[model samples]
Target chain A: MKTYSIVLLLCLLTPYLGNAQENFIFKKAYDLKVLGRVSEDTSHFQRIDSADLQNLPPAVQRYAKFSAGMNVVFKTDSKSIKIHWKLKKMNTLWNMPSVAVNGIDLYGWNGQEWQYISSGRPNSEDNQMIMVENLDGKMRNYRIFLPIYAEVKDLEIGVLEKTTLSPPDTALVPSSKIAIYGSSITQGIAASRPGMAYPSILSRRLDFDFINLGFSGSGKMELPIADLLAKIPAQLYILDCVPNTLPEQVKDRAYPLITRLRMLKPEIPIIMVESVKREISNWNSAMYTRVNGQNDEYRKTFDKLVAEGYQNIYYISTSELMGDDHEATVDGTHLTDLGFMRISKTIERYIKDSIAPLQ
Target chain B: MKTYSIVLLLCLLTPYLGNAQENFIFKKAYDLKVLGRVSEDTSHFQRIDSADLQNLPPAVQRYAKFSAGMNVVFKTDSKSIKIHWKLKKMNTLWNMPSVAVNGIDLYGWNGQEWQYISSGRPNSEDNQMIMVENLDGKMRNYRIFLPIYAEVKDLEIGVLEKTTLSPPDTALVPSSKIAIYGSSITQGIAASRPGMAYPSILSRRLDFDFINLGFSGSGKMELPIADLLAKIPAQLYILDCVPNTLPEQVKDRAYPLITRLRMLKPEIPIIMVESVKREISNWNSAMYTRVNGQNDEYRKTFDKLVAEGYQNIYYISTSELMGDDHEATVDGTHLTDLGFMRISKTIERYIKDSIAPLQ
Candidate 1:
């Protein structure tokens, strides 16, 4: 009778004892190998230089602070993963879910490809949540993508007791980057999650680091942004800013930006993208005229640049970006996960076929 | 000089005059030809019978009021579309965007196919917004899908003052319905917008009314739900409730539900679907076991039914639903637009090849 009672007592206390033994070893994100950054900002996860904030426009500065394409890559042999993160501020978007705007997307490398495990769903400015658990506890490579539209104030990764968590022995992605500069779409405005963004998807598919320099409402090929792009040393540069630039702005700004970027990086490949066709323009005549006008002006600029004997320069039209079904966007403008995937596949084809580094 | 002054004054008053002349005629949703309904509840936009609500579980009753897959189809010559809507209550989900949970999706049929125009982004319980403006003044077919997760209190459509807003000259979709009963996924839990739900996508592609009988957490193949489903006069019935039912529950309940449904509707075709393979299960052993166990029990029940000489019955496995990549879901469970599109395409292929009515 005493043996049975003792056994029952031990069973009742097993869960609590196991929980007590879960000694979590937390690692600051600053100590990890971060990807998709061109500037060394003071903030741990920002995309651009902290010093450039004062010189740039307010919107650009604010958007640059978001860790749109930043991710931390590490190796761990833990059965569980947990995160305690604090956002710079609590932000909400009408068309974007909080999971995309303020969440952590974790993926595990399964030999050949990265597979999604879970997302850290945020509840407030500061949140602590278990991302995934009950793993087989093999030493494996893992990448955790940061929030696409919000800034992280602080981040710490937690693993089970006595588990090994260290920097990866080999570089998973190449050091050479494909830097993309564009509008809100490039900034991943309406992706279902951060990892579904076009740049992140392309990085996973192409096995290269793709830097995101997308500035929401500010990717107008302004000289300030162009100068910033010229400073980043990348193997390839893709300019996809026609959607955010007016026709007159395109004619005025496209030539100087491309020319300066060419002078700065003499032999690097550069691809120019036209404004994507908007489904709303199918019915609204005014929007049709405006978007088509922007594209025409952008095309003229590209023709002039080609005539000037620019080498290793290319242009991509809108015809091949989003599919013909017109169901890829949440609003008439912002691309959803479907749109992001479609666009990324198109870009991936270009990178694989034309760019020597990726090939 | 006096004539010039009058011309300038007229030009200054043009916007106000146009605004005053832009009279809108409003129509209640009850006056339109609505689709994807099995019951004639007093509410203009509910899926189930109001009387049956008292007898069902609270979760099922609450979910029944949500007008998932319900849409209004009409023809109009108005150059713009506007809406004034009220919700039963303001609700929010961690994984779903507000635009999907509470917004309205509008699609206009061109000569060949339906094209997405814009989404009515909701602000509060009582909301008014212009869905689309500056459309070409042509008599066109339009369909407006309602919120997927929120119940509607009242809805009204507005068009140009003199333009006709009448029922479609011919039925755009067939009269026969394909009733799909399942969990929150069938209710379009994490879709980016209302029209991206699998049922909505299938309706557009197949041109048939695909009814949504999904209860969020209550799709346990209960006898009451089975009886309710049996009463609906559908040409085909798809049982997709395995995700919400445990192995034991499925073993105890699936046979009775199928047998009862078959006994009532002898000729109607039935399709039983295995639970979808969740990406979370790839790394988590507990989830892997649970989901796989549910599918195994469901398959056994299906095999039993087929062996018992059940004619016009079929089964669908989970292998071909979401793509090999694990990026289809916002969470590891509820699908995003990408996942919804993929799953809908898979189902569409099955229907086209197997279902006689659709073919």
Candidate 2:
């Protein structure tokens, strides 16, 4: 009789043991908040069709389009979770299908093979909110792969049946977060694969997050974008819109752009990026002068920022970005993947030792 | 009789003006030497085709494919002429056609517009020596822009038209050279234009000569490539090949790569680069292990080198490069142009402060 009891006990505990061994579980859900309004013009927003959210990886599963002011409630049974986000104003440029929220493909390993979960797309209506759910519960440690610009008001968590709530992990590991604001390059255009870009490589090296606000050719350091950037947080902000801007425009906008960012995030590091040199030597007769002039203006702004008790502002010389040996660049404008990596490494080191510690 | 007398007076006076503006012409031709060969097979050595030489910028007119051997020669009538060059190798899977240099194209600035002179596809069997001649005597300060690899052993100038050589009113300034070696990102893949690549931008900022030997997916720190790199004189040698190599591979190669470069050029500054993190989760899996292993190996190597009296080596963590945010990357690997600019600035400052002085 005792032997029979023992067997039954073992049988009863087998299911529990299996559940424990399956470590992957959802933890908690949060209410994703958006402070903006949906544009009345539906054409200005992106409408996501019914797709398989399960196809996306956990990192990007929560990215879904919704109307503005709509609450995205994420539910999980896990305890504490980390959050990251970004936001941008809706404009005509943002309405294009190609300009929708990109770089949100997520993947996870299912022991033997990697599986996809979900992806993010622009909302169909401007000023609408895109929300994600089941993020914290889906993975133990969560990472939102896309650059989200909405306001993150609060997070909610709950302990599972066999789990307990724990404090968030905040270890001082060597990490970095670079915020890139520019045009198509910032949007990962023309790369053979998404991961082959320099920024992606840099992120892999640094063990940090990235906020890419590249809006195709539409990204400029305009007031609307800068205002949006002011709300989110980052360790460094890289401004690289000169390529899309005319020289006169750069000259007119460079100083104001730096000043705006400095005013918002006084202590964060800001690296002003210049446009790459053109392959066509004489494409723009005033390119040299305009670039030089904009550079000088940036310098002046940096100096001014430094003078105004903002110590982390710096200017990255445009020449060092490409053509150092003149072989890394493709047409004197865009870089090959190798060129991007070379340039990213150079900047990665500077930010790690020189900029991040200040934060 | 009066016209002949006037012409004689003009001719006599012309000599005085020509002599006044005479520039010093070094007698010996510039000696451009090929250091050594780097190829999987020596039987198919890469050589510069003379026909292709006509396609280079007016400044870099030469016939010489860089091949293994120290016997290559470069002759110039002026001691300081702009050097331009092009080299070809097999393109990789991840390489984009926009960034590949399969043939040579010539560009010239015609005061008001830039003109395409010629383009040539190199025939493997051609034994033509590249040549650069001053077709127009009006080219006062010959500026040579080398788009490819052709080493300069020495430089010389010679008198033309029997005129005595004197220093020209303006002198050619030799920009500090920055050499970078890495994978596809370093090769400037996906960049919309060549100048948009970070390395090129950095060059423009620093006014430095750039040598971009970024091989797409080929920067595995192989000994042959390193051997090639060792022969080139540079202010800085950036090793950013981690993204192209698996973490395990990086672990195996990082130390040896650094050690070999140090062995070849003891005094040159070698910046060791760490791989960037992927936006995808599963941070504790093979990717993390590989990256961390490589990074640890690099650190250990750096420490060992420093312990062994190598003080010039530096480390740039990937974290600092990408910042803590996750949006900078386009598709978990490559960077948007904005990301490229950020990285370019970071490295530019480091080069300016750390390596520029040495150069």
Candidate with best TM-score? 1
Q: Local error of candidate 2 at A4, Å? A: 45
TM-score of each: 0.93, 0.40
* Tens digit of per-residue lDDT, candidate 1, span B1-359: 56643433332112111223466899987687788888745556889868766757888888989988888888899987777789988678777789889988889888777789888788899877767667888899898889999999898888988899887757585677789999888889789999998888888887678889887766888877767877787878888888777677789999999999998888888888777787777887866776687789999998898798887777889988888888899878888999999989888877765577644
TM-score of chain A of each: 0.92, 0.52
Q: How well is candidate 2 docked (DockQ)?
A: 0.03
> Candidate 2 — what's its lDDT?
0.43
Across A1-359, the per-residue lDDT of candidate 1 in tens digits comes to 56643432332111111233456889987676778887745546888878766667788888988989888888899998887888988678878888889988899999988889888788898987777778899998898888988998898888998998887646585677889998888989889888988898988877677889887777878777767777777788999988777777788999999999888888788888887887777887755776687789999998998898887788888988988899998887788999999998888887766586644
Pairs with backbone N, CA or C atoms under 3 Å apart (clashes), candidate 1: none
Per-residue error for A98 in candidate 2, Å, reads 8.2
Off by over 4 Å in 1: A1-21, A41-43, A357-359, B1-21, B41-43, B357-359
Query: Which lDDT value does model 2 have at B7?
Result: 36
Quality class of the docking in candidate 1, CAPRI style: acceptable
Interface RMSD of each: 8.3, 16.8
DockQ comparisons of all candidates to the true complex: 0.43, 0.03
